[model samples]
Target: MKISTLITAAIALAATCPATAQETKTVKLRILETSDVHGSFFPYDFIERRDAKGSLARVSSYVNRLRQEYGDNVILLDNGDILQGQPTCYYYNYVATDKRNIVSDILNYMRYDAATFGNHDVETGHSVYDKWIGEMNAPVLGANIIDTATGKPYVKPYTIIERDGVKIAVIGMLTPAIPSWLGEKLWKGLRFDGIEKSAKEWIARLRETERPDVVVGLFHSGWNGGIENADYTEDETENTAKNVDGFDILFFGHDHHARKAVVKNAAGREVLCLDPSCNAVNIADAEVEITLRDGKVAEKKITGEVRDICNEPVDSAYMAHFAKEIDEIKGFINAPIGELADTIYTRDSFFGNSAFTDLIHNLQLAITNADVSFNAPLQFNTKLNKGKILMSDMFKLYKFENNICVLRMTGEEIKNYLEMSYALWTNQMKSPDDHIMLIDERNTGDMQKFGFKNFTFNFDSAAGIDYEVDVTKPEGKKVKILRMSDGKRFNAKKWYRVVMNSYRANGGGELLTRGAGIAKEELPGRTEYESKLDMRHYLAEKIKSEGTIYAKPNKNWRFVPEKWTNPALERDRKLIFKR
Candidate 1:
C-alpha cells in the first residue's frame, strides 16, 4: 500500500513540473542605438584630420557581437542626421556616379532597424532625402512630417517587429520646429504637426490594433539646455517632456545630450526616456528581460548601461575600408588652394571671439567686394592648424550646398541689426548674487533663457582690418574703428561692398541684414565653391596680387561703458564672461 501511494505522488509531481516548465521561458532582448550620426561613420575626425574614435566599422563589430550574444533579439537603430557629414556626404553630393548613396551603403552594412529625420538631413534638400529613403534597407519612420501637396504622410508612423515571440511597436517623431528652423525651401511643401497629438493618435492605434507587448518612441527632438530654441526668452524653458501617452521606452536625438529620465504623461503613468551624446563619443545600451507565463510576458525587467565606444578596440576591417575611402578623398581636399600665416583658427569657442570668424569675414569681404562684411561664427566640424589647409578641411568648414547672395539695406536698418545683437549679447550676462538679474522671462519649463552666450569676433592682422572694442562698454557702442590694414578709418556714409552667403544675405541669421541696401547682386557660385576655393585661391586672385589686406577702426560707433555706472550690469557682465 505504501509503495503504491509513493508511486502515485511521484507521478503527480512529474506532471506538475512539466506544466510549470511549459508556462515559463526567459527571453532577453538587447537594443543598440545611435542618434545624430551626422556622417561620422568612419573613425577619421574631419576637424583634426586624423584618426579619431567612433567608426561604423567599430560600431558594426560591437553590434555584431551583441547580436551574436542575443541572436535574433537585438535591434540596431539610428535616430537621424545620417545623411550629412564628412566623406560620405561629399561623395554622395559630388563624386558618386550612380549616386549609389554612401550613407545607405554603411547603414545597410550595419543593418539599422529604423531612423527618424533630423533638420540637417533636410539641409541637402528634398531630392536627396527621397533617394535615401528608397535606398535604405530599413523603414524610415516619422509621423509628424506631412506632404503639403498630397496631404499624406511621407513615411510610416510606426512599425511592428516580432522578436523572440514578443511583439514590439516602434514609432518615430521629428521635431515640429524643423520647418521653421530649416527654412521653407529645404523643407518645402511639408508640415510638421504637434508631437503630442500625432503621437497620441499613433499610440492609440498601435495599442488597439497591434497590441504590442512594448512600445518605443524614437525621436529627433532632443533634451533641453543642449540645443536651445531660437526664441528662448527670460521666462521660457524648452519642453523636454515625452508625453506620448503610452510608450514604455523613448529614445531621443538632435540635442546631443546624454540623459536618463522618467517622464509621466497625463494618465499618471511613467515612461523611460533616454538620449546619448553625439559623434560616436559614447553609446547607450539597454536590455529588456521578459518572463513568460502561458506564452505571455508575466513580468519584465529593464537594465541599461552606457559604454564609451572610443575606449574599445577599433574594428580592423571597417577601419581599413574607412582608410581607403579617406585616401580617395584626400587628393580632392589636399590640393593647395593658398597659404596662411602661423595662426590657429577654431570654431569651438562659444564666448569672446574666434580667428575662424575673422577668416570668414575676410573671405566674404574679398568674395563680394563689400565695405562691411559679416558672418555668424557657426561651429563647423574642423579646427585649422598652423600650416597649409587641405580640401578635407574645407569640407569641414562648410558642409552645405548654400550659395552667396548680396542684398541692399539702409543705414537705419544696419543700426537696427546692430542693436539686436547688442541686446542679445548683453542679456546673457547675469549675476548669480542678484535674483532679478538671473530671473529669465523665457523659462519655458524645460529650457534656460541664456541667449547668445557664445558670441565673439576677432580680426587677423594679415586678413584686413583693425577695430577697437571697449569690452567694458555696452554692446551697441563697444565697436570703434582704430585702423584698417591700409591705414584708413571706417566711414559710415561710404557704401561698402560686403559679401555673405545667400542664406545670410537673405536674412538667414538674426540681425545680420544691416548692410543689404546699397546694391544687390547674386554670385553665380554657391558658398561651398567659395569655401573650397581655399586661402590659396583667394590669395592668388586678390590679396597676394595686392600684397596685403588691411582694415581700419571706425570711431563713429561709440557709447559709454554700462559696467561703470550700473552695478547690476557690471556684476552680471563679469560673472557671465568669467570663463
Candidate 2:
C-alpha cells in the first residue's frame, strides 16, 4: 500500500476506536442535607417572637447557590424531626388539624428529594404523620420502622436516583429508641429496629437489587458508638457506617449535633459522613466527584462539610411564596390568651424555686386538686414579660406535647421521687469550685463551648413539699423533705395523691421506676387521673378564665449550706447564662 493510504487508514481507525477522552468522564454530584430541622421552615423564632438564626429559607439560599453552580446533579434531603417543633407545626398538628399539614406543604414547597422520620416526628402520633405521608412530593423513608400488619417498612426504605447515567441509591433509617422514650400510643402499630442491623440488611439488598454506582445512608441517628460488636442502639449511625459495607456517604441527625468526617466502612473503604445540626442551623454537604469509565463509576471522591447558615442571606422568593402561611401562623400564635401580673423567666428555674415552674405547678394543682405536684421548666431559655400573654408565650412555658396526670403515691415514694430529681439536678460537690450541675465538662465543655449537657426539660423539681437539696451531701441523702406545704407531717408510710405530667408517670427520666421503686409495668395502675388535653391547654384556659394571672415561686424548695452552695451556684449560673 502507498504511504498516504497507510496514513489515511491509521487516522480512520483512531477516529472509529474509543479515544482516551471517550473512555473516562468526570461528573460533580453534590448532595446537600438538612437534618433535624424540627420545622424551622421560616426564619422567625415563634417562641421568642423574633427573627432567628436558622431556617429552611436560609438553607434554601445556599441550595439555590449550589444549584446554580452545580446545576441538575445536586440532591437535597431532610433527615427528619419535621412534624413537631415550632408553632407552625403545632398549629397544624393540634389547632388547625388539616388533612395535609403546613409542614408537609412547606417540605413539598422546598422540594425535598427524600426524608426520614426522626423519633420526634413519630411523637406527633399516627393520625398526624399518617396523613402527612400522603402530602409529600418526595418519598418519606424509614427502613427500620415496620408496620405491624405487613411486617415490612411502614414507609419506603430507599430511593434510587439516576443522574446523567450514574445511579445513586439512598437508604433511610430512623433511630430505634422511640419505644424507650415515647408511649405506645404515639408509635402505635409501628416497631422500630436497630440502625446498624437495618443498614447492613438494606445496604446489601440495595447493592444486589439496584446495582447502583453509589449508595447513601440517610440516617436520622447520631455518630456516637463505633460498631455493633460491643455497642448497639437506635442512635448508631456511626456504628452502621463502620459495620455496613456498601454505603458511599451517610447523612445523620438526631441528638442535634454538627460534624463532618470521612471514616472507614466495614470493608476498610473511606465513607463520607455529614451531620447538619438541629433547627436548620447548618447544612451538611457531601460533594462527590465521580469518574465514569465505560458508563460506570471508576473513581469516587467524596468530601463532607457542615455549612453554618447563621446570618446567611435567605431565599427571598421562597420566603415570599410562604408569606401568607407564615402570616396565618403568626396570627394564630399571637392571639391573647390572658394577662400575667408578673414577669416569669426560665433562667431562674435552674436555681431551684422559680416563678417559671411555679406557674406550671400552680396550674397542675388547681386543675387536679392533688395534694402534691411536680413540674419542670420545659424551655431552656424563655421569658414572659409582664402583661398580656399570647398563645406563643404558652409554648415557651411548656413546649412538649405532654399530658398531666394524677398519680397515687405514698409519702416515701414522693421522697424517693424528689431524691432522684435532685440527684440529676445538682452534683455532690466535694469542693466549692467543683461543678454544681452534673455536667460532663470534659466531653461537653462550657455551654458556650459545647452547649448544655442536658436539655432543660429533664430538670424537674417538686412544688408541693417544703424541701432542701444539700448539694454537699451524697445523692440519695441530698433531698430533705421537711413537711408538706399545708404544714402536715411528712409521713413516709401515708399514701398521698400527687399530680405530675404523664411523662413522669410513664417512667420518663426514670424517677418513678428507679427512684420511687415502682415497677415500670405497674406505673399505669398508680395513675388516678390523666388529662385528655395537654398541660399547656389547661394552663391557657386557667389564665383565660381569670383574665389576670399572678406568677410567683412558692419557695417550696431550696439548696442548703448557702455558704458553699451560693458560690457554686453563682459561678455555674454565670457560666450557663453567658450565651
Candidate 3:
C-alpha cells in the first residue's frame, strides 16, 4: 500500500513538472573572445590619423548581431592587453583621470561578461590599473596573481554564468613572466605564480565546488617560450591546456599571433584553443552544444574559429554614442608638437643605424647622461614624414610606454649583450649573396615576407660605443669593440653607466640575463636610475621645448665584410621593403 502511494505521488509530480525538463534539453553556447585589443576602441587610429582596418566599433556590429540571435546564450569575453595602445586609452589613462575611465565605460557599454589582465595592463602602474579594476562592470580575473599580504588571489579568479541551466565557468590568468618584463613598482603588492600549477589547482577546486558543466581558460600569454628559460616559462597556455583536465576551451594572446587548434589533454579529452591577434584585428569564437538527458549532461561538442573584424562595417549607433570622446582624442593627437628636418624610416634600422631608432637612443642618452645607451626599433615598418610633427607622430616614434633605466655595467658585459642581440638579429654569411638577416626559413620565402626568426622589437642596437659586427664571423665572435665614440680608450674591464628602457633592464628581451650572463634575480641591484614615466614624456617635452629639431643617425656602429653583407642586405631589403 505504501509503495503504491509513492508511485501515485511520483506520477502526480511528473504531470505538474515543466515539459522542457522531461525532454532531452540542448543548449548552444557561443563564446566570443577579444584578446590583446591594445586600445583600437573606435573605428579610427589616433596615431595614424586614418580609418583603422579593425576596431571595436566594427566588432560591435558583429557582437550585437550574435547577441540578438542568441540573446544571453552569446557569452562575450575579453582577454587582456587593452589598457595601453592608442591615444584612446592614453587620454583616459592620464589626461582625463577626473572621470571614469573610458575603457571602463566602453567595456560596460559592450556588455562584456568578464575580463582578464595582461602584462601591459599591469604596466600602467597601480594608480592606473587599480582604478580601472574598480570601474569595470564585470570581474577582472587573474587566478595566478597572488596578493603577498593576504596570501590569496589578487583579483577574482573565476566567474560562473548560467545559460538555460547550463553552467559555464571561465578562469583567467596572465603570463607569470611579468617580473622579467616590468619593474617592481608597477606590480607592487602582488606576485605571479606559474600558470600550469594555477590551472591544475583551479580546475580541481572548481570541479569539487562548482560542478560546472563547461570550463574555459582565458590567458593573456603566448604559446611558446621565446628566448627565455630556467627563470620562467613565458608561454604556459598550451602546456596547461594539454596537461590539465576539465578545460573545454582555452583562449590566449600576448604574442599577437592568431591560431586555432584542438589538442588532447592528459585524460585524452579534446580541448579547443584559440587566440585573436592584437588590436581588434580578429576575434576568437567557439561554439559549444551540450545535450542533457534526464537532467544530466549526456554529451558535449565544441569547435573554435577566428573571425576577421577588419571588413565588418562600423556600427553607426556605436560610433555615434562615442562621438564626443572620439573627437576629443583626435584633437589631442593631432595637436602639433614640433617640426622635423627630415623623414625617418624604421625599415632602415634593420640593415644598420638609422635616424628612426637613433632619435630614441639620443633621447635616452641625454635624459640619463649615461655613457652608453641601447634601443630597438619598436614600431616595425613605420615611418614619420618630415614636416610639422604632431603628438600622434610622437607615439609612432615610441610605441610602448616604457620607463628608461640607467645601469652600471662593465664594457665586456655590454659587448656580450650585443653579441646575443646580434645572434638573434643577423645570420653569419659565407658568400656575397648569402642572407645576413635571420629570416624564418619555414615562412613562404626566406626573405620575401620579411618574417624574422625572432621578434624585431628585441633586435637591440647601441649608441656611444664604436663597434663592428662581422658577417663572416660566428655569433659570439661577430662583435669587436674599438675606442669609444669620443675617441677615449675603451677598457673591457672598466665599469660604465648605461641607459636602456626598463623593458631591457628588467630582462624583457633576455639581453642582460641570458646574454650578459647576469642572473635574472640580480638585475635589480645593477640599476642606477629608472624614469618615473615613459621615455615618450621626456621626448615630447624636449621636442616642445626645441620647437624644431634635426634627426640623424649616430653612425658609430656598422656591419663589416660590407662587400659580402651589402649585396645580401640590398637583396633582402628589396624583398622586405619592396624597393
Best by TM-score: 3
Regions more than 4 Å wrong, model 1: 1-19, 225-242, 320-324, 347-355, 380-383, 399-401, 422-499, 502-579
Candidate 2: residue 552 lDDT (0-100): 93
Candidate 3, which segments miss by more than 4 Å at Cα? 1-21, 441-450
- What is the per-residue lDDT of model 3 for residues 316-367, given as tens digits with 9 covering 90 to 100? 9888888999888888898899999999999999999899998888877877
Candidate 2's displacement at residue 456, Å, is 2.8
Q: Quick one: RMSD of model 1?
A: 7.5
Q: Indicate the worst ten consecutive residues by lDDT in candidate 1.
A: 231-240
| Candidate 2 TM-score, true structure as reference | 0.92
If the candidates were sorted by their lDDT against the true structure, best first, what order would they fall in?
3, 2, 1
Q: What is the C-alpha lDDT of each candidate?
A: 0.58, 0.82, 0.88
- What clash pairs does model 2 have? none
Best by lDDT: 3
TM-score of 3: 0.95
Residue range 73-123, candidate 1, lDDT tens digits: 998778887787665576675566365677776777677887778767876
- Candidate 2 lDDT over 1-579, as tens digits, reads 999999999999989987488778999988988987777888889878998899999988888888898888999998888887788888889888854698778778877888889877887888888888888898999998999999999999999888877899988998776765667888888888888788878877887788999888899887773212222374687777788889899999876667787889768998889988788988998888999998988888988799888878988999888888888889988899999899889889988789988988988898989989988777666799999999999888887777889988999998888887777678889987887877655435221123445444657788777988888899789888899888988889999889988777787767787788898778778988988877788988988998998889898888878888888888888877773
The regions of model 2 sitting more than 4 angstroms off are 1-19, 225-234, 442-452
